[model samples]
Target: MRISDIPVPDTTAARGALALATEYQTPALTAHALRSWLWAEAFALVDGVTGVDRELLYVSAVLHDIGTVTEFDNHSLSYEHAGGHVGIALTAGAGWARERRHRVLDVIVRHNWPSVDPSMDAEGHLLETATALDISGSRPGDLPEVFVREVLAAHPRGALAAEFGACVVDQASRKPDTAARRLVDGGVVAKLAANPLELL
Candidate 1:
C-alpha cells in the first residue's frame, strides 16, 4: 500500500520513537529515511512470501523500534510491545480490522528474531538484516572483515547482514571516495555538511 494511505502513529508513539532513537544515538535523518525505505522493502518481501497485506506490514516495520525509544532492553519484547501499542492506537484512530491488527503484531514480533528463529518470513529476515547492517557501520575502516570471514560467511542471516550493511554504508557515504574521506576526516561531518540531502 502507498505510504499516504497508511495512518500515522499517535503523537506520543512518534515522540517515543524519536526519543529512543536519540538515546541510541541514531542519526536522525538516516533513521527517518531508513525506516521508510526499510518498511517498503520489508513489505515487498513479506507480500511475496505471504499473502498478507503490504500496508499492514509496512506499518509494523515503521513502528517496530518505538519501544527502543523507551527503556526496553530486549529488542524482541520491545518490538512486541511497541506493535501492540501501535496496533491499539491505529485501531482506535483508523478503525482497523482485528485480523489486520493481529497480522501487523505478528510481523513486528517476528522481525527481531531472525537469527534464532527458523520460521522467519522474508520480510522478517530483511528487517533483521537491515537493522544489523545499520548497527554495524560501513565506512572503509569500519568494515569488520573478521565478522564477514569467520562469522557471517557460514550463516545466511549473518552474510546477508554484512552485505546489506556494506550496501547501506556505501549508499550512505555516496561513494568509495567519500568513505575514504570520511575515514580521513575521522567521521562523515564534512561530507554530510556539504551535501545534507545526500544522506536521505
Candidate 2:
C-alpha cells in the first residue's frame, strides 16, 4: 500500500519517534525503515496475528537502524545493541512505562537476529522478516503485487541494496565481532547478488 494509505499509530510518542528517526537516518535508510514497517504490518494482517502494538512496532522499526547513524554508533557494541540502547534513550523522553520501553528495545535488538519464530514474538518476527524482504528480496512473492508496487513507488529503493550493503560492510570493517561481519562472511554477497532489484 502507499505510505499514506498505510496505518501508522496515531500517538505523540510514535510521531516523535518518526521525526527523530527521519532526522537521524539518511534518506535511503529512512525509506528502508518506513518500508520495513509496512511490510511487517502486511505480514501481520495476512497471518491473522493480533495483539500487536502497532505503535511499538512503528517505533521499533524506525529506530532499528539508529545505531548505524554516526551519532549513535558505538565502536564497542553491535549495531543492533547500540540501536536498542539509543531507542531506549529516545523513548524514555516520551514517558513510556519502563516495561513498555523495554519491549520496544527488545524488538529493535532482535530484529537483526539471524532468525526468529513468529509464534514467540510477533513484532520481532515480523520486523526480522520485513527487513530480510526489503534488503535481500527474500520472499517478495508472498506479498501481493499491488501492495509491493505501491510501497516501492512511495519509498523507492534508490540504490538501497548497494547503500545498505555498504553500510553493513562498513560496520563489519569497524567491528570484527558484529553480526554484520558474520553476515558478510556467511555469503551475504551471494544473497545481495540474488536480490531481485539488482537487475533493475
Candidate 3:
C-alpha cells in the first residue's frame, strides 16, 4: 500500500519525513536510491502484514532511520538506536493511536538486530529481515544469503523484501567505498533499494 492509502493523522507528517530524509547528501547515488526504495517497501509491507499492527509497523519502518540519512557510514545500528525517540514524536505527530504509537516505539527501539533480543522474535522480525536484505546488497554475495533465501525468497513477504533487498545493493554498488565497502546510505534506504529486477 502506498503512504497515500494509509490514514495518517496528518498528511504533512509523511511529507515531512520525506523532506527530512532528503535533507542529507551521500557520496553514493545508490544510497539515495536505497532510501527511497525502502520507504516504498515500508508502505508496501504495512499493507501486506497480517495479524500485525499495520499502523505501528508502517510508522516505525518509515521513521526507522531519520538520523542515518544525514551522516550514514555503514553504522546503521546507531541510527536505529537514535531513531527511537524521533520515531515516537513522528508517530504521535502523524496521529497514530496511543497504543499503536507505543507499539511502534517498541519496534524502533528493538529493531537493531544481533545486538538486541535475538530470541525475542516478533513482528520486528519482518522489519529486521527486510532491513538486512537491503544491507546485504543485490549480488547475492553482497547480502546474507540466508536473508535472501529465507526472508526475501521463501516467504511471501520475501517477494517484496527480496526484490527490494537486491535492488538497493545493486544501486548502492554503483559507488563503492574506499575499502570496497559498497556503503549504502543508511539501513532503511539500503533495504528498500533491494529490487533485483531493477538491475536486470
Candidate 4:
C-alpha cells in the first residue's frame, strides 16, 4: 500500500507556497505542511483520484496552518479563516486567476472541517483527509506503514504536536467560539498525544 514517491510540484505557486511557509512558519510547522502534501499525494495515488489541481493543493497544504504563526496571530479571526486569507494573498501574488485563488482559500478553510465532500472539491477533500491523518490520526489504518515511514523520514514530526497543541490551546483561550475551542474541548490534545505518527 505504500507509494514509491511523493511528488512535489515545481511551479511558481508551489515554490512561492514553500517559501512563504518557510518564512512564516516554524520549521516544525513547515514540515507538517510538507507532510500534509505528501499525504495528499499518497491518497491520490492509492485512490486513483484525478482532476485535482496539484499547484492549488500544494499551496493550500503549505499555507493551511499559517494562522498559527505569530505574525498572523494578532487577529481575532479564526486560524482557518486567517490561513485561508493568507492563501488568497499568496495565490494572487503567484499570478493565479481570481477563481483559482479562491479555490486555494476554499481548500485551506475546508481542511479544518470535519468532512469535505470530494465531489464538491477534490483538493479540499484530499487536504482535509490528509491533515486529519497527520493531526489526529483519523483513519489510522488507511495509510500503510511504509508510506508513513517515508513521510516521517522526510519531515520528522519534530515538536509539531507540542507547538501546534499550544497554538490551538491559545487560540481556544482567546476565541471561545472558534473551532479551536471545539477541538480542544473534543480532546484533540489527547489525540495528538496518542497519534500513531508521533509514535512511529
Candidate 3 residue runs with Cα over 4 Å from true position? 1-13, 24-49, 69-77, 115-123, 137-200
Where does model 2 exceed 4 Å of error?
A: 1-5, 197-200
Ten-residue segment with the worst summed lDDT in candidate 2? Answer: 191-200
Report lDDT (CA) for all predictions.
Answer: 0.42, 0.83, 0.45, 0.87
Residues 162-187, candidate 3: write the lDDT tens digits.
44344345434633432112334455
At residue 76, what lDDT does model 3 achieve? Answer: 30
* Candidate 3: residue 13 Cα off by (Å): 4.3
TM-score against native, each model: 0.42, 0.92, 0.46, 0.95
Candidate 1 per-residue lDDT, tens place, 1-200, comes to 33334344455434443343445523442254234334335334433545434455445555555433334323333334554565456544555667656655665555545242324454454454444344323221222344333222222222222332343344334433422223324443333333222222
Question: In candidate 2, what are the lDDT values of residues 1-200, reduced to their tens digit?
Answer: 44566678888778888897888888888988988999999888777777888888999998888888899899889888898887777778888888888888789878888877877788998899888888777787888888888888778777666777788899999998888898788766667667775453
Q: Give the per-residue Cα lDDT of candidate 3 at 46.
A: 41
Rank the models by lDDT, top first.
4, 2, 3, 1
Candidate 2 residue 68 C-alpha distance from true site, Å: 0.5
Q: Backbone clash tally for model 1?
A: 1
Stronger candidate by lDDT (2 vs 3) = 2
